[model samples]
Target: MPDYNGSVDYLKKAALRGSRLGLERISELMERLDNPQNRVKTIHVAGTNGKGSFGAMLTSILTEAGYTVGGFSSPALTGITDSFRINCREITKKDFAEVMTEIIPHCEAMEDKPTEFEVLTAAAYLLFFRKGCNISVVECGMGGDTDSTNVLCFPLLSVITNVQKDHTAFLGETIEEIARHKAGIIKCSRPVIYGGTDLTVSDLILREAKKKCSEFYSTDYFRVSDTSSDLSGTEFSFDGMGDFRMQLLGKYQVMNAATVLTAVEVLRGQRINIPDEAVRRGLEKARWHGRFEVVRREPYVIYDGAHNPDGIRSAAESIELYFRGSDIVLLIGVMADKEYGLYTDMLGSRIRKAFTVTPDNPRALASDKLAEVFRAADIDAEPFDDLAKGVCSAYEYAKANGLPLIALGSLYMYGDFMDALNNITE
Candidate 1:
């Protein structure tokens, strides 16, 4: 049997085979594995952004209601295993290795090998079913139509957190094109909820749901009022859903929370017995890291996974809202393919000095090239080859200058952030 490291290396090599976005390989794997996805109820989440946050919130609410729920998200914050978790507990390395052991032989026998993401998605389905999860919240890897996670035949509900320009290379260049792919997750006769107000995107999703005879609900009507917000957290009220508080910083989070309440109401309509107390408790406890997360205090170190335009805008807004008058420096690492115009346009004003590091990923943009982008913004920029060294240098500079430091960009770098922070504290 393969150990954890061996299993991870095998998947890494499998990733080199590249991502083939379609359901054929996944469908075959599911059929061979006895279709465990259908055995467990799932809530399909797809969108350019906020899918992770929404899934985390729903998982917390369901767990608070005493149901065993599994959650699956991408670019695993805790490495590969964290991508598959139950009730917020990451799958153990031992369990992951054992599952890979069972899944590998089947992969080897396949005529057309499954993509790395497809294999992982199939494994998550089997893991959720075998672990006796009453429910699971699954986020699509990319566009919904061909994403590996779209294999769910029927979901309890389908959620599109928002529609935006992302993954344009494959999802298409326009908002409508990207939205069509995202709307494909709307299963027949199932309830579908959308958290975005882009009229074109909403209309497409609504039409798709209507075509499939699915009930459609949009959270656009929900009124959200921010009661209070500080570095600690935010307090808000979503119409009749009652007041709630969450440690997740940013006004955007308030929007995500409202969408979550709308989902709870939809679940209630479906006869799922979730109590109000559970909703309140769940909101208070729900946390999805790497989105405007403050990792250290005193000198103030923050981390945000704002790899794209929308995310960059949100992080910039939150920084302005929280630290407008304070001195702030930035530490950035982004993908080679991401859109960068918004990065400088949105965050340029807040940056005092910038440190660039190449994230630990195959597609990461070179640190020096990223620094060149920063320098174009007319901000002082420096590049470091070693991520940990760059992080320490950024923190030290921030400390000496009496400025807060925010590390932003690719989610793939979060694991590296923890490692770098450990080196600093130790």
Candidate 2:
């Protein structure tokens, strides 16, 4: 059996092939391994945003309902192992190594070697099947139609959470085109739930659901009667479902909860046996890190992976809602492919000062270029090639000036920012 480092290295080598979006390679690889994905029940979630939050909430609810739940997501927060989880815990290094040992030879023998994500998806399915997961929740890495996770033939449910203009190079440039890509997860005769408010996007999804002959549900079906949120947490009520509270902060999270609650109702209709108590407890306990996550309270530092335009707008709105009248320091880093101009423009006026850093990725936008964008938008901006220095400067400025510092942009930078914060605090 391979050691953990060796297995991780193997996966990294596969990643060198890069993101080839299609199901052919994954399907062939899974077939070579006897297709373990077919043995498990799955809920497929696809969207530009909120996929992780929705998946986590659903997994928590399933686990709370006393089922062995498996969860698969992508671009893990801290480590690759975080992508494969059971009962909210990442697969142990030993288990990850064992699974890699079992699959690497098959991967090597394949005529067209699978990409890293495809291999990981196969590994997750095999692990969940072998470990006896009662149900599995899979979040699509990108567009639903061609994502590796689309290999699942029939999922228990498909959720499309708020389609936005992202991954335009692959998905599409227009919202309607993007909506079509997200809508591809809807299966024949299955059920689908959508959480987006855009009428055009929702109508497109509705039409796709109709074409698939699937039962459709939307966030419009649920009414959020009362809602309150701060950096600490969010509390809200779903008309008849009762009041729920969660550690995840933001108005968007409240909408995500409404989507999950609507999904719970659909699950109940399908006789899943999820009790109201389970839903309440699951929402209360479910935590998705790196989205408005507070790492320190004294200087009031927040880290959010709001890389896209819509996400940046939401983060800006949350800042206004929670820290209005306070000086806000912005620490930003992002991938080169994103609309950095739009992102900076959306939150520029609110930012008292900006510190830009390059995220740790090949596609990272240069810190100097990001600083230029912020400066062009009339926000005071500075650039740093080193994340540690950037974070330190931001923290010192925020503390000295009595301002709240927010770190936003690419998820790739989160680990670096977290490490820097820990070092400074220590």
Model 1 per-residue lDDT tens digits across residues 170-269? 9999999999999999999999999998888888999999999999999954478757888998988877777889998875888888888999999999
Worst 10 residues of 2 by lDDT: 220-229
Provide the clashing-pair count of each candidate structure. Answer: 0, 0
Residue-level lDDT of model 2, residues 1-426, one tens digit each, is 568999989988998999999999999988988988888889899999999989989999999999999999877888888888999888889988988899999999998899999999999999999999989999999999999898888888999999998999998899999888888889999999999999998889999999999999998634896788887788888997898899998668888888999888988887899988999999988978888888899889998889999999999988988898776999999998998889766787778999999988999999999999888888899999999999999999999998999999988778888989999952
Clashing pairs in 1: none
TM-score of each: 0.98, 0.98
